[model samples]
Target chain A: EPEVTQTPSHQVTQMGQEVILRCVPISNHLYFYWYRQILGQKVEFLVSFYNNEISEKSEIFDDQFSVERPDGSNFTLKIRSTKLEDSAMYFCASSLRAGEGDTQYFGPGTRLTVL
Target chain B: GQQVMQIPQYQHVQEGEDFTTYCNSSTTLSNIQWYKQRPGGHPVFLIQLVKSGEVKKQKRLTFQFGEAKKNSSLHITATQTTDVGTYFCAAHAGKSTFGDGTTLTVKP
Candidate 1:
């Protein structure tokens, strides 16, 4: 089955450095989302994108965070400057529809480690 | 944003024993989804329940959506060592919110 794919399974960056997490969602999916999980914490939503724009975002998705569909298949989350708290497993998900009724497929996730 | 909660933060069971996890949402959910993440791995979608009071099963697993559509449960029959992992119930409103998750440890 077609699945979401992310690049750089793991990343290590210095505090205050910039990092970009990339994802390739399923071809036919229309809604894309970004979520992250701190070690030993619940997965938290970051943002949602549709029609090439952000539909909603969580408080954690502050000014430091940005997302883009630079190309047809590439969905990316950029952190302007990493903080120690930024270290977490970032996941990308996509679904064919916009409702909870639709199943969202997730990528394996990119483990971000900021020191 | 919505809030989803899961019960029994952790569970320990012997092989051949049964396991169950509960999921509740503070707000009415349009739908609920279950996912399993093995230790050191990522979350994988297991099932989705939409209709009120709907029930679905997969092999040794059974899932139910509450009649009020505010809660759900996942039941596993005859657990195995391979069943050890964290199970999460994610409810999607406009945005998706995942519960803390129930970690299941099946001792062999």
Candidate 2:
């Protein structure tokens, strides 16, 4: 089964530095999403992307966050400046469609640790 | 903002015991999905429920969606040690929102 894959399984960066988390969603999937899990917290949605644009985003996805489909298979999330609170396990997910019942497959996740 | 709440943050069961987790959404959902995550592993899709009062079963596991589409439950019969993991119920309104999840620890 084809699955979503993310690069840099673990990322460590300075508090004020910029960081990019990369994901390669399933080749045929159309909609992509980013979610984060703070240590023991519930998974939180960050943003959704389709057609090279953001469909929706949460308050946590503020000015510091941006997502892009720089290439056909690459979906990248960039944080302009990392904060301590931003440290979490970031997961990239994709589904063949954006319908309510569509099943979204998640990647292994990239653990971001900001110092 | 929509919220999905799951009861019993943790569950411990001996091998061959049964287990169940309940999930309630603050608002009506168009659909609900269940995922399981093992220790240090990613969330894996288990099942999806679309219609109200829908029920689906997989092997020894069963899932149900409430008539109001605001609640759901996952039940496992005679669960084994392999059933050890965290189960999360995610609701879809416009976007998917996940519950806090119930962590199951099965002792063999």
Candidate 3:
């Protein structure tokens, strides 16, 4: 089955540096999302994108965070300045549709570690 | 903000014993989804329940959505070592909100 894939399985950056996490969602899926999980915390939603724009975002997705579909298959999340708290497992997910019952497939996740 | 709470954060079961995890959402959900993530792995979709009081089973695992759409449960019958993982219940109203997940450890 086709699955979402992310690049740089692990990322280590210095605090205050900019970093970009890339994801290639399923080719046909329309809705894309980004989530993060602190070491032992629940998965938290960061933002959702559709129709080439952000549909929704959480408080965690502040000015430092931005997402773009730079290309047909590439979905990238950029953090202007990395903070220690930004160190977490960042996951990308996509679904054919957006609804209550739709299943969202998750990628392997990129572990971000800020020094 | 919505919250999905899962109970018994950790469970240890014998190889042949059964295991269960409960999830409750602060607000009513339109649907609920279950996912399993093995240690050091990504989350894998297991099942989705949409209708009220709906029940679905996949081989050894059974899932249920509460009639009120605010709670759900996942039950595994005769769990094996392969069942060792963290099970998360995600509630969907407009966006997805995942629970803290219940980690299962099965001893052989």
Predicted complex 1: CAPRI docking category: high
- Give per-residue lDDT, candidate 1, residue A64: 100
TM-score of chain A of 3: 0.98
Tell me the lDDT of model 2 at B91.
Answer: 76
Clashing pairs in 1: none
- Candidate 2 deviation (Cα RMSD): 0.9
TM-score of 3: 0.98
All models, DockQ values? Answer: 0.81, 0.75, 0.77
Q: What is the lDDT of residue A64 in candidate 3?
A: 99
What is the CA-based DockQ of model 3? 0.77
Q: In candidate 3, what are the lDDT values of residues B1-108, reduced to their tens digit?
A: 898999989999999999999999888888899999999888899999989999999999999999998999999999999999999999755667899999999999
> Which lDDT values do the candidates have, in the order given?
0.93, 0.93, 0.93
lDDT (Cα, tens digit) per residue for candidate 1, span B1-108: 477889989999999999999999998887899999998888898999989999999999999999999999999999999999999999877778899999999888
Model 3 regions lying over 4 Å from their true place: none
Chain B TM-score, candidate 2? 0.97
- Please give the distance, in angstroms, between residue A72's alpha carbon in candidate 3 and its true position after superposition: 0.7
Task: Give candidate 2 misplaced runs (Cα > 4 Å).
Answer: none
Per-residue lDDT of candidate 2, residues A1-115 (tens digit):
8989998999999999999999999999999999999998888989888889988888889999999999898999999999999999999999899836899999999999999
